[model samples]
Target: MIWPFNRKTSTETGAEYYIRDAAIADAKTLVDFKHRIWRDMFGHLKDEAFFTQAEATTDEQVKFWQSRISRGDTVWMAEDLRDRLVGTLHATTKHSEHTAEFVAAHALGELHELRYFYLTAATAETTIGTELIRTAIGDQPAITWLMGHAPLVETNLRQAGFEPLGEPIDPSDAPWKGIPRQAMVRQ
Candidate 1:
């Protein structure tokens, strides 16, 4: 289901932006945006060699996002006045018993995982990201893995009513290995 929302750029400026369900055709753009945002936010934490070896190429990211979009994962995109994609949020229902167990432990029902939530630097100054997150998680209890370094994301989630729960889990084999990530939940 698509959750549509509209918000003005900033209180001082009245430019409007739209947030809607992502389409398969948006996969490439979404991937590119993700890459740019990721590098902008976390690149300084890693060396050039690590990025070269760990980051997925544009084609790989395109295929990954396309598959997720086609599979009907709850993905939302934020677009500017010109309809350029600037932000994205994706969520998936809990599928694994282990994840379900974690949700149960947190006293959250039928949990949905916040898979990817990001906004371009330009759009980050706006309320678009918060609205996208709020709409995406709508009446369902949700959980997310948050990097320790991403204070902005943590603050956003907390403002949306999510709280840190459990200990930080190590993403051993992922590109984010060695980065501390904590699980957060909102009921």
Candidate 2:
């Protein structure tokens, strides 16, 4: 968590967990966290109709995360005091074309995409999520996909200066087919 509620500090506090850059060794843990949180956020991941291309390939997710880390895009993982995975934050230079178009239409300039910032249900009300976000993007302008299912997260983003753009960024793949995703931007 962000100790003393200081966004300026990046050091781990004497809280429940600490955040750090994800390493290659963390692939499996990271993948597991993604699935668990997906279930927490989206509920129908196991329904099979929503698709599993991404879910079916743990190795691909690992490689994708490794690529993000190697490319130095913002990818941070949170671990509890016992060193167990608890949360994650990823901001990427890569985003959907719709996001790009909306940014261009509004003249928002270059902005990183806050791909996903997830904290387990246990850490939801804590400062760890905020810490991860501040560490990942600081005060830089950025965009992100907000789950309509997560009101508190959206509220936090709004407080951080992100607002919904256009109608909503349409889901491109099967995995995201039924989930409502809005492109929130900060210029």
Candidate 3:
């Protein structure tokens, strides 16, 4: 449903937009938003070959978001006054196996890298990205592994009390062929 921007609702104030859990029905919208954001954020990252191949396709993104929702992960989105989703956050519940192994790798006696958090690019002024990170962190204090990259992602992550753990790492696990993916971690 298109959220009325100026209309008063329990979800948000008139002056600003708000965030909510993404639904299966939002698949198409999410895909479109994803394409736009990716094109903007990574359009200039590498060679044209990489850009063309890694470009966001509607079908691919829809399937991805659908899978994320079906897997029980939550996708939070921010709608502008026009009811358009300008920003998005995708997060999975705290990891068990990875966190345990990470602790061992780091040699920490007791470590808790709770959940993994990610955000999509949109208008920088809205601060929706920042709010999404904050909300997720607030909901799950155990989340210790927030992940993202880019200058904006770093800024938002820092605002949420996350520290720079290291350089960004590629997020794509499959042989997607051309699109390059990278992510930064915060604890």
Candidate 4:
């Protein structure tokens, strides 16, 4: 469902981007958004090999998103006037295999997970992310991981009553590990 730009939603007003449900065809665009987020997050390091490795997983990433969207996960996306995807909030009552491992590791039970929340730099500081978060998860108790680099996300999570879950850890798996992320849970 595409949200009309001029229409005001319960959570936000004057938003430059419209929030909508993502379709299966959006899998590639979601993958591209992931790449853009990674670029903004790590490009300044100028790590060519890391980016090359990330590129190697593009098809796999696209497929993963396709599966998620098809299965009714990660359903929310924010788009601009031109219909370009600017942001998304991946929240679900179910967990992915790796995320289930994370929940097990953290001893979290009976909680939804906000796996990935990304917005282009332009929208990063706007209310769009907050609106998406509220719309997707509401006051439901849930868990989320935020990279240390995204102060805006951290702030938004904090505003939504999410507190630090544990010590910071690098979320990346082997072969590419440099980020220090914090886990938070709304309790």
**Which ranges in model 3 have alpha carbons more than 4 Å from their true place?**
1-14, 48-52, 55-57, 94-104, 107-123, 139-149, 168-186
Better-scoring candidate (TM-score), 1 or 3 = 1
Candidate 2 residue spans exceeding 4 A from truth:
1-13, 44-46, 49-53, 170-173
Residue lDDT tens for model 2, 1-187: 6645554333474466778888777777888788767766777433643336557887888888777667666569888766777778788767678778777887888898887677666676777766777888888889988873665567667777888887865576765666777888887
lDDT of 1 by residue, 1-187 (tens): 9965544343235656778998888888887777666676677666676666645577887788889778877589888776877777887885455567677776677778886787665664677767888788775778887763565676677777888889987767757677667887887
lDDT of each residue in 53-102, candidate 3, tens digit only: 54546678678778878887677777765577877766544456655555
How does each model score on lDDT? Answer: 0.73, 0.73, 0.56, 0.76
- Per-residue lDDT value at 77 in model 1: 88
Task: Give the lowest summed-lDDT range of ten residues in model 1.
Answer: 4-13
Ordered from best to worst TM-score, the candidate numbers read 4, 2, 1, 3
lDDT of 3: 0.56
Give the candidate order by descending lDDT: 4, 1, 2, 3
| Model 4 vs. true fold: TM | 0.80
Cα error of candidate 2 at position 179, Å: 1.6
- Give residue 41's error in model 3 in angstroms: 1.8
**Residue-pair clashes per candidate, as listed?**
0, 0, 3, 0
lDDT of 1 at 49: 68
lDDT of 1 at 149: 57
